[model samples]
Target: MKFEIGEIVRFRKKHPCGDDRWEILRTGMDFKVKCLGCERVIMLSRPKFEKSVKEKVEVKE
Candidate 1:
């Protein structure tokens, strides 16, 4: 799966805020993601990020 900036992805695990959705901020060796629920930002390694992704969401806009 190709991950791009501004893309929304669902994770296998739910965040503390109860949302499993995350927005891709920066993608490279590491991925920067913002939680859709709490709007909190975090970084994950490429492998880990890919492994945790449940599905890729098509952004309406």
Candidate 2:
């Protein structure tokens, strides 16, 4: 699973806002993700993100 910055992914779990969509802000050991539904930002580790992500919608160049 290859991920890049600015990509959108749908996580297996829904956020409190009831949305599973997230936009990738940063990638590496840690990732900066912004929730599409609530416009909230969260920092998550790579392993955690990988485990949470159910599908990658878009890949940034």
Candidate 3:
């Protein structure tokens, strides 16, 4: 469940915008994530965020 800021992540559930992908903005007790489809920002608790995460997308250098 290790992740970093600026990493792209997928959730088990799709967003209202119909995208399941998100970009990690901030990490800690709460995670700040941005929706890739709608460009909306949201904050989710660590436990909630971790449970919903499907996978982390590899970022290219």
lDDT of 3 by residue, 1-61 (tens): 7878999999999999999999999999999999999999999999999999998886624
Q: Mind sharing the TM-score for model 2?
A: 0.93
Q: State the weakest 10-residue window (summed lDDT) of model 1.
A: 52-61
Q: How far is candidate 2 from the true structure (C-alpha RMSD, Å)?
A: 1.0
lDDT of 1 by residue, 1-61 (tens): 8888998999999999999999999999999999999999999999999999999886635
Pick by lDDT: 1 or 3, better one: 1
lDDT of each: 0.94, 0.94, 0.93
Cα deviation of 56 in candidate 1 (Å)?
Answer: 0.6
Candidate 2, residues 5-36, lDDT tens digits: the string is 88999999999999999999998999999999
> In candidate 3, residue 36 scores what lDDT?
97
Kindly give the stretch of ten consecutive residues in candidate 3 with the minimal lDDT sum.
Answer: 52-61
